[model samples]
Target: MSTFGELFRVTTYGESHCKGVGCIIDGCPPGLPLTEDDVQPQLSRRRPGQSALTTPRDEKDRVTIMSGIEFGTTLGTPIGMTVPNQDQRPHDYSETDLYPRPSHADWTYLKKYGVKASSGGGRASARETIGRVAAGAVAEKYLKIVAGVEIVAFVSSVGKVELPYLEALEDGQPIGKDFSNFLDHLTREQVDADVTRCPDPATSERMKERIMQAKEANDSVGGSVTCIIRNCPIGLGEPCFDKFEATLAHAMLSIPATKGFEIGSGFGGTKIPGHLHNDAFYRKADGSLGTVTNHSGGIQGGITNGEHIYFRVAFKPPATISQAQQTVTYDGESGTLAARGRHDPCVVPRAVPIVEAMAALVVMDQFLIQQSRQASATLLAPLHTPHHVLQAKPQPTV
Candidate 1:
């Protein structure tokens, strides 16, 4: 769907190689500090050509606020923004009209709609995520100010190159910092310092080499982006069908080229026995409940448990490649088509911001829903109180 979320709604518009792309953010709480500056960072991060690993196509991707703010503060109306498309080479995709790139959305989109945009994958292009990234920046700001929530994502793996797993501390002495510390100290600077976006310098080098190798071979590589949401409050999700993780999976998979989503123990937990997989709870030094382990990934029963919400998103390699391959044209005639265009040899690096954006949207949406529920219940809290226990008589309005 073009619109996402129940309370903090966001509707994205425009397409790849189009005039511009952006989003309308509705339901943003009033008086939150907001501006083009807040949204531009994520857009810049998602933009192509900043590094050798991504596509050469470069558009400043600068955004302009069209509505819904006054004096650098949100007005709680539908916030409209747009970023004009520049440097679009529609001619590069001219051949795609006749022959859909293998594994690309060209064919499926053409089938769904009788007519399709001749240039780019239209909305299926990674460029479509610009709006999401923009709207997410707004949501992120709200979450940070209201809840002290921090969201960050990085390229966790590229092809076979993977960072070492977060194993338990030596002899259960808690060698590593706890989830709060990890989230507190994990800054975007550390991630952006390297081209691969992997926090570890060594692993980032290997990941960059892998992307360069794919570019040299006229091929592509797939990888995963891991995101962490810290300081999220408990009870920020619904039960049953609308579980937090389920909605989170839906958001992550909505991004172009995304193939998988995993939270907490995810698939690996299946191998471990229940005892090892379960996160044991205890009272913390602050007199608050805490979990000794985080196998649950900061969530249990699909709700945030005040722990760090950690997850990974797997993205397939960008489908458009320079390699020649035999494929059928739109008319079913056999042909060999070699795609030509500026495309990322690997998408995981650019996907880091998109992953973080989507995470922020989910968290913000859930937070708003929970807040509304709590507010309504609290408003009616004294309605059913026992008459004998009432301290003072209710005052009457004139």
Candidate 2:
């Protein structure tokens, strides 16, 4: 269960407050040029103590590549990486020994395994994402090299401090003017320009204030991240049970604290009739077919349609807060428990890279699977349908 991906599999190890945490990546293509530099920037962005709004955990989150590369080139072998826990304070979590943190993994983990880590939330800790981010960097490198794919994620909302772009559109209403532009060319620098990572300067400021309010109150806030995957080739997702959007949803919801996942128009798409919500097709100047709109979120029937794939991931407020709450202990005795530890007041800011990483993993694995299928299918003779069968359903023109 710890492993993710089929061809580009990654199995994460270690835990919060343990010696360290990392992953082993299997099935990476051979001879790709990679180094610590490619992986470090994303990890640095995900690490703690970056700004006033985040936890002051003071971890460099420096990664050490143990194998799978020699002199900056992959050898078609498993890749290993690790990031040590330099600032763990197991003693800080002494209160958890008497009680399970509400909405955290403590109670369920104990009930399932009959034991749990004494310090941090064990596998439930956000620290567990270090391996995901690292492995994602590798998969992203390959995707970029082979298909020029690009992935970016940013905080879109922090407790209602949201961009106007995410607002649901009514029938005959058009998308926000900047929505397409934002998804098409937004850069990580533009996203990382603000501490809240919300992309809009004014909105980022509001999100920052919201997070600070929670930090000051010894409470926590929740928010959502919007991610975009551009330049994905057509026919990437598996239909039936493993649709592209479904796999993406699986990937996003797997992260710690994730509560919701929506692609394209998501829930709002349900408001309009088929005619108004449909993405009409058009012929591009280059003679290729394109959609006049992207209500499908760059996918059609669970496969990429050569448009930007955009989605949103919602994270719940961190449960491990310093605020005192009346809750039952392990033995059913109720008492006031105030948790102690360094945790993000709003996880969206730090969650941006994690979201991007998971997106890359999903895209890369799906790409490899589809690519292999196409390669094998190319060797077979083409299916020649009868003219009557093809004419039964008239296809539309651009």
Find the candidate with the highest lDDT and give its number. 2
Task: Tell how far residue 345 is off in model 2, in angstroms.
Answer: 0.8
Model 1 clash pairs?
none
**Most accurate candidate by TM-score:** 2
Q: Model 1: residues >4 Å from true position, as ranges?
A: 166-184, 382-398
What value of lDDT does candidate 1 attain over all alpha carbons?
0.85
Candidate 2 local lDDT, 1-398, one digit each (tens): 89999989999998999999999999999999999999999999999999988888989999999999999999999999999999989988998999888899999999999999999989999999999999999999999999999999999898967887766453435555478887999999999998898889888888888999999999899999999999988788899788999999999999999999998888767776788778999978866678988989999999888889999999999887888899988999999988778888888899999999999999999988987887787799976778777332211111
Q: Candidate 2: RMSD over Cα atoms?
A: 3.0
TM-score per prediction, in order, is 0.92, 0.95
Please provide, for model 1 over 1-398, each residue's C-alpha lDDT reduced to its tens digit, 9 standing for 90 to 100: 79999998999999888899988989998999988999999999989889888899988999999999999998888999899999899988888877988998888888898878889888888888999999999999888887788898988789988876633321232213454366557889989998888988888888888899999999999999989988888877799888999999999999999999888766666666677767888977866677977867888898888778888899998898999999999999999988878899999999999999999999989888887876787677456567688453322110
Model 1 RMSD, rounded to 1 decimal: 5.2
For model 1, give the 10-residue run with minimal summed lDDT: 167-176
